[model samples]
Target: MKFKISTGACFIFFSGLYSNLLLPAMELQAQNINIPIVSQHNALVLQVDGNKNLSTIYFGKKLLDQAEYNNIPELYKQGTDYTGILNAAYTPSGSRNLLEPAITVTHADGNNSLDLRYVSHTITQVNDDVSLFSVVLKDPVYNFLVTLYYKSYFREDVLEQWSVIENKEKGAVILQKFASANLYLKAGSYWLNQYHGDWAKEMQPEESRLTHGIKTLDSKLGTRTNLFQPSVFMISLDKPASEDEGTVLYGALEYSGNFRTDLELDYQNNLKIISGINNYSSAYTLKPNEVFTTPAFLYTLSFTGKGNASRKLHQWARNYQLLAGKGNRLTLLNNWESTYFDFNENKLAALLKDTKKLGVDMFLLDDGWFANKYPRNDDHAGLGDWQENKQKLPNGIASLVKEANNNGVKFGIWLEPEMVNPKSELYEKHPDWVIKQPGREEYYFRNQLVLDVSNPQVQEFIYGTIDGLLTKNPDLAYIKWDCNAVIYNAYSAHLKNQSHFYIEYMRGLYKVLESIRAKYPKVPMMLCSGGGGRVDYAALQYFTEFWPSDNTDPLERIFIQWEYSYFYPAITSSNHVTDWGKQSLKFRTDVAMMGKLGFDIVVSRLSDHDLQFCKEAIKTYNAIKPKIWQGDQYRLSDPRAGSIASVLYVNEDQSSAVIFNYLVNNRYNEGSKMPVLLKGLDPVKKYTIKEVNLYPGTVSTIDALKVYSGDFLMKAGFNPDVNAERPSVVLEVNEVH
Candidate 1:
């Protein structure tokens, strides 16, 4: 149940649900919080004014209550006066492990109460003047997430302080308090920032231009309103300003983490806040009130070594070694379009022959080998039934696997393990197997039921089913795991009021990956949640690569691929081809190189010239695959700003490197010679650069591209008039050794 309480200067909120799975009920207890004067740096002092007796905080039946106030500066740190706070209560309950603490915090005026029921052992520490915070969920897995919130007041005329705290590695630290505002990238290292008003997805303020030195990008004063209601500014670090040495570390203080080459903008009507967890941080803004009422929260976080994150990433990389790793990187060909339901072994083998000629290494059967009924047996009928169709391939999977192996390719199969069809045998046997409300009609999408991953039996069935296939065929090279449709009407048979659709679903997925890795430590697995539908770090840490998008249009990929590169490692992206409508083949190949280059293309139907081009593109990708896959990427232009240029560079040896630049759209006037300034170069080295020109009647590597010291000028322009409006350039260089 949710509740609202108002006091002399605070608004207390009661959220009954706990945030994550890490604490139990037995150890948690009800407690009260007193607004104390927290002084920092000896130069600045902060005090939560106007509140005294706050002893009304309690839970159902109130089993345990502790009100001892002890300032443990060592555990919580007291040297710094300006810092953020993130605290949680842990209680051991029954046999369920640990549960989160639930209690109400009554305000001094007795007009408001803030009930905190769910918490994870996470905190955000903001010190000094820089509005910033960090997330502290210890390695080896911690059992809580800490969140802090307070009502901000402001005059209706001013744009005040309102932002979210962040950490360096985790990307973002936000309290997505409302359901209407959705995160654009969905998940990654995220931080929060509040503009003049609600976030304007596409607003580019003229005052906030890229700077070369340390300078405040934005400083505005506005009244904070929780849904347009008058309140003061609330500014905290999503990512601290100190996080960047210069204004243009890469480009701007982008919300995009290490790999961000693009910026995504959104405009919301509500007072929405987000976070970018970084180092020791804090939020300090004025609260204007001649009279007020309500209570707030202090969120703090602690930092671990950077390896805490890289270690997780490394583990994931090893687990999905088939799409990565040396020698073991399985080159795969998926027949999603070719055999949506029609291809048998002969048809598959025919494609495999062509795939082999083009250096393809794995033959994958997509979406149609199990159901004998045509269009009728699509995602709806054949799902959950792993049996191979007799008429489609009379020899069965073993024979097909053997045939593919003989043709110099490994075999893989795709499955949506999280769903089942009503027509399937599994569903018929246990109608209660799927998640459903006791009486509400369960809606179906793609003619399938959302398998109850929350149920251990369901999880076991999935794990055993896939494990059985792999055990039967030790030669299986890969598995394409997919989850279709968005989650709605969430219900878990094993949980009550436990609408942990996101958390539980992720847990089940991790369990599956863990089991897979434990059993087959070397098999490569690719994650394809309806083509980047479920793209997030939680999943990336388990699978090697994620299918970027089903849309292969190079034009569309420019933005999608650009954004994906912002925070994630390049090797995590999986590019594929489908029968996309009217897109230039050159552009498609160009975009595919941004990720793990492969052909989802149909060579059998393409012209000889197109087919040859594809072969050469593959070879080109192979030649510089190391750089594109491992090199650092920079976003030369912001798509949000109406420019059409995105560039990625590869520098493996530090001696030689290559770049891929795309002119997304010719928005600049005919005479505008857009500047192409290269980044991530050794400013100390006097290197030589050559431009690979593609135009007119011939190709030439003009080695005359001049070099300029990065100390003074950091930009150069390319003459579009010389190469015509439709031009692309590849810069190759060798460092002066």
Candidate 2:
């Protein structure tokens, strides 16, 4: 058999014997081949030995020349490990390999061992910026096949990998464990950076040093999978991790269901990373001729530190994963915090008027507009019934949409279709629609039960719910799709075996989302699982932005946004000003402007001075929205390290920039003066800096007329006057013509 390898415009062919069993060691030695998947800045080289065993030979900075591959074997010679454990590219359970396997299966005839050997390979150029390389492997003893796929985003320095496992045996094969990708790195002292938080507080960065054991980050919440984000950064301690100067390896799983990422530092100092769907209570049974594919694991290797790695991932996401891409996101006013559940048509009309008066782009009617029988007056009832409450809306949702549009403001609504409260009309009619184990009492979370999305009927119902809303009101500008509860008593009556609940549920959710996206392609949607719960690439592909946290307090948001920016771009982060904290209006607006700016406060209730400040802040945010959404982000200071946090954003052409400085707390005797160093600016360009969005009586921090060279601003950074009264400032820098 001939295997064709294509690296860019170059192609090579090599001959190998096709077999169902492992070839003899001597015969296989001559057929060994090295495959290199090259990106713009990195290369991942895989070696298939004569015995058909595949392993990673090298994965790091790009090779200068193809000839450099010849020395890799000699540089890292094979060891004498008789147990057949040498960082096999895609390890399977069996063959005396003791390390964690990427795949574990129980085959027919009660045989549970699997030893996959390389069968064939192919490479295809997907586009100018992307390429796909696939390798097929099969267990010599069983009619089982596993195809590993690697897709390289060449220009973005990002690689995505996933596995497809097919069962060709007569009887059903049970798959106990399956990982999307496995990577092995040479022994080194490494530090792992991960994000951990709860519902109202998400994306809190935590760093730890790796030791000689297994370190795992996983989430089994089933639905709100991001309680522990399915992403991490590993940096070598040799070159300490900094914003822009270190070797950083980032891996993020695209799955939104139960997921796990394991980092193992073995006795030999070798490191292994296994990331994909969590195997806890999710053993899938594959029938004859059936195939199961894992979610894609996205990764990038950066030699220039966490910032570079983040930019690469962000570029790739905008190019492919995110639905909104680099487009502008709308700034809206969400009414959840404004009115909670007590509002009528007159109240909503007043909010709509405020939305237009305040120059907000959209007015969102959140949570209380739905349901007729149960009234939806609080969190306890009216979840599953997707209808307008006559008492609240009076004239219905179409009227509200018309009113907002007539006022030159867009309209949006919120729906939690994947959840149903026990007091809801839909739940009362169909109790079996929820996920509950047979003959067991159901567990309630937030007074609601998780809809059995794994059931086809439930999927259809969810699709219909959104479809009805969009169809009835075509002018509805946005949607806030929420899933407020996690799966409990997880059992899928639609499935014969209950172990497939998590995987099937995710599949079902995706199916509904796909259907919706296909129809309402232009409608922008926001994914919110009580805030940051559904923050994964799989869901982001369909939504425009996400609520980073339910805690809209400016101080808490400073930390949340800082950590979130390390992976997700600002365009996808929906930050809103609220009345939840003691921060002043200017402080709240300055913090929210760092991301896609919005508001969740009752505008009419604001003091006259504060109301005028909101109008001016909205105007300023609109003027600089492009720089914040599409510019390169530089985190100048970390809130965790000090009492102040700062961030800078510079446009692509270096024509414009914005800096946000936030003071977390007031120090009694110390002066509130700190240097704000800039990054990603043209050293030769002279720019004018001005403080924007200042309240009527607030003190100014910038001259608003002085021009300074970028080099001077970066080297001799300017000091901002951040005091207790004015705890934050937004500096706008425009290149002087």
Candidate 3:
């Protein structure tokens, strides 16, 4: 079904269809344009004119096949109407190229810069669902060549693009800015949806109308810190987007270090959005023949609104981004709040037994595991010292691991391998290994400093520490990897140009991850930036799950999950059920079910009633875990706009489903009530729905069992009493004849 532009012509099959869908590929247009083109069915079409300049043909439901061959210097001023794919310093609008430049490089002469000139392009069919479009761009003036790659998954309604910039001059070239991908769209009423947050709050979805000038989100932090993740964004140009209806252009960058997402409206009203690395220093020097490749920028357009847009992103991530595929979502329990930095072998053994009693699958020992040499009792002392704290774990982690396995729990350890404490033995021995300028005042977050991971020695230490622990403990099934601080001094001892530190830092971090994964490919890993800091498909490529935020508040988590669901899979979320102070087991468990479900509070200390609730919830979670991972996720209710939040998951085959509805707040005397419309169901079939008492005890007017047509369930909807302040209901819908 997938073919390339062989010989001289290529075929495009139209694929936008659903209720009253239109324009099937059967109604084909034999007509071909002079310019060569590549397309993903009829939904998207791309072309390059005679100048070897790329242009958009079809994006989403719009067609932009018209070519502007006439050389109008003024048109370049009117935004991206006639501008080529790559804008450069050699252009007529040099220094004022408002549109996002694909690559920025300093010329050898120091005055004469480079403009992107077309070289050649090739389309290679990689697989049935994937096609790679590679275009070569040259900055002849600077002797620089950039190879742009666009990989299209025709079936998934997704396209990813990245560029490799190579310096060909005998001397070095100074790289200023580089974007993974730049896109131009016909402009109109534009609104940008961005997920913004800080520390305990991450992925709080927010939107605003975009006006003229530029709207930007850039993260200068070493990691894709949650404070500002300029990595994923959704744009609505012509109308205010809704959950289920409206044109939405969704994009996510695959890089984790210093990123920026730029959206600008030109003088002509056209829009240009760019996603790529943030030039923290604009001093990255590239040696001749050395290539710098940008991260893959993945994007897709959905006519059916943000929900569908998110589904495509989530699907792409699960299918192609995760380190492991469709892994089990075991009921994991963490001993963080339970015993912050205070726990020993005895405490852990008791907790492990409680986890087994509650049917918890994994026991993640969070923080304070190493460095008895300098005593890592808190955040200040002992980091980077990857030795066992003999006092804390007198017997080491062997007996604990063995006991955990025997208790039917997978044992995972927490480690912050990318950071070091000045008070630790490791830092005292190798003081220069930290990321700091030689003569500048050093900065630290959480009493920890980042490692100049660019150094080969540092990378080796990190890799060995992690690989050694995993190897030593054969039963170690998971890792809670944490990076607590951002780059401060941004200097590397081995590198002269400090600007390249950001790029090399990621390279070194990724190298360490690769080394560890090569040794323990199947082990599930968690990437935590203290709690919620680092996020992006590039980091997601190595980590199995992410801690959304340290705050486990149920009401907050619903909104966080809603935003994350669009770009990341539930499996990648470390949604822990935490009884942080007054939270009940039911409310916490219900929210955690939306992600890679886990526990954080002390289990053994819980009352009998609470412990019973935990046992029952895990049993329910185990049965429906697969469906949650592989199902089509739907946001039945928006938590922000209303007091009720609801989510539905339907199996790929549509034969089974699980729905979770929670009352976010107590506003009205009456129960929080709404008709939750279901999606991704076979309307032709009948289904039996049963109300599951997942929380152990709850009051609801919803019937115990009922049979309904899928059509009725979607159109008429199911109404339940979401009255309790933290009340919730779980529905098990089965296709029954």
Q: Which candidate has the highest TM-score of all?
A: 2
Instruction: List model 1 lDDT by residue over 1-737, tens digit each.
Output: 11111121111222222232222222233432322212121010111112211111111111121222222223332233221111222111121212111211122232222222332222112212222111112111211122233211111000011112122222212221211001111111223322222211111112232212221222111100111110111121223222111111111111101111112221211111222211111111111211111121212111221212222222223332223432224456677766676676788878878777666677777776774442224566867777778787788788878877888888888888877777777677766767666688877766777777757788888899789888888887788887664444556677543523433444465566667767776677777755554444434434667776666666666666655554345667777655563545665666666667666666688777677666666666676666655655554444544344546464644555566655555544532246555555666655556654232234554545565443212255332222324434455555655
- Measured against the true structure, the TM-scores of the candidates, in listed sequence, are 0.60, 0.94, 0.90
Q: Model 3: per-residue lDDT, tens digit, 207-313? A: 89888888888888876455555478888868978988888888877777778877877667767777777876746777777777777777888778888877877
Greater-lDDT candidate between 1 and 2: 2
lDDT of each: 0.43, 0.82, 0.73
Model 3 compared with the native: what TM-score?
0.90
User: What is the C-alpha lDDT profile of model 2 across 222-290, one tens digit per residue?
Assistant: 998786564545545444588888888888888778888888887666788998889999998888988
Indicate the worst ten consecutive residues by lDDT in candidate 2. 1-10
Candidate 1: Cα lDDT at 54? 16
> Among all windows of ten consecutive residues in candidate 3, which has the lowest summed lDDT?
1-10
Name the candidate, 1 or 3, with the larger TM-score value.
3
TM-score of 2: 0.94
Q: Tell me, by lDDT, which candidate is best.
A: 2
Query: Which pairs clash inside model 2?
Result: 28-50
- Please give the ranking of all candidate structures by lDDT, highest first, separated by commas: 2, 3, 1
Alpha-carbon lDDT of model 3: 0.73
